[model samples]
Target: MLLILLGVLVLHLIILVLLLVSTAANAWTIGSTGSTDLWYKCLTTNGGYHCLPASNEDWIQAVQALMVLSVLFCFFSLIAFLYQLFRLVKGGRFFFTAVFQILASLFVMCGAIIYTVMSPDRDVSSSFGYAYVLAWVAFPLSLISGLIYIILRKRE
Candidate 1:
């Protein structure tokens, strides 16, 4: 039981970290000379790297909002999980945590899909970057974690 609890905690933590990294890392789209993220578009020039605020496109803004919300919800879910772990009675389910986590995963999925559909096709050289991949990766993990939380009953 201890090992199972620890494993769930670790998985939750991993999802949270992945959400943070995917939200903050400026590598959603990578081009030959630059990269673009939710907040900034950065490029490398002659011995210098420059960054500028992301465009005001509605899709980009939506993605930004969704990603931020995902991180917030995931973090909140972790806190809720910890709180419930100690306070809940034996046989109680972590429903609150599961709901928050599932919502976080949905947010991530929506944000990534919006970015993929709306991002400009800069050129043949440009491609989705590691951070984009991470966002995609986190979505399923979060979903799975949420399901696990739903099924996990507090044990004495």
Candidate 2:
């Protein structure tokens, strides 16, 4: 039982870290000339790189907000999980934690989808970056963690 709980905690922490990295890293889209992310558009020129704040598009702002919200909710779920570990009844499920985590997953998925569909930089030379892949990876892991929480029951 202890080992199982520890594994779940580790998984949740990994998901949290992934979310943070995906949200903050400026490598969502990469091209020959530069890269663009949620926060910045970096262009490489004359052996140097120049960065500018991302465009003020409402959709980009929405993605930013969703990513931030996802991080917050995932962090909250972790805290809730720890609290419930000690306070919950033996048979109780971590429903609140599960809900928060699930919401976090949904937010990540939505944000990534919006970015993929709405992004205007569809040049043939560019490709999606690792950070974008991380967002997608985090989505499933977070969802799985939430499902695990829902299925878990405290055992003494």
Candidate 3:
């Protein structure tokens, strides 16, 4: 059971990393450039041609900052959870660690939500892809991990 929990935790971390990387890529409009090219040629609807504007370094930098902070929180939460797993005792440490982990998850979720709500449609490049889906995926996993931490008990 412990191993299973550890595996889940590791998987959660991996998804977090993927989320961070994908957000960074999205912020910089990486593959979106080629996507824009294809979109312009293949899909020309009533809403003009779908071509991404030139990269905006400033916007990218701002998004990167948010991503960096989210990543940091995830990393810290992972470490704290692992530590609590090892040092699981009926004490204040357990509660504190669990609280921190949950807060970290909340922070990541909030940042992602903000990005989604505030981000312009053109920033999305193509309106269809796995990147957007991945963000949604990470959101739930992180939330689950936080919940797990809250319910977790030390079986000594």
Give lDDT per model, in order. Answer: 0.95, 0.97, 0.55
| Ranking according to TM-score, highest score first | 2, 1, 3
Using Cα atoms with residue i matched to residue i, what is each candidate's TM-score against the true structure?
0.97, 0.98, 0.62
- Which candidate gets the maximum lDDT versus the true structure? 2
Candidate 1 versus truth, CA RMSD in Å, comes to 0.9
lDDT tens digits, residue span 23-82, model 1: 999999999999999999999999799999999989999999999999999999999999
Model 2 Cα lDDT, one tens digit per residue, 72-134: 999999999999999999899999999999999999999999999999986999999999999
Runs in model 2 lying further than 4 Å from the true structure = none
Q: Residue-wise lDDT of candidate 3 within 98-128, one digit each (tens)?
A: 5655555565566556545544444444453
Off by over 4 Å in 1: none
Q: Roughly what TM-score does model 3 have, to 2 decimal places? A: 0.62
Comparison by lDDT, 1 against 2, better one = 2
Which is superior by lDDT, 1 or 3? 1
Q: Give me the displacement of residue 111 in model 2, in angstroms.
A: 0.2
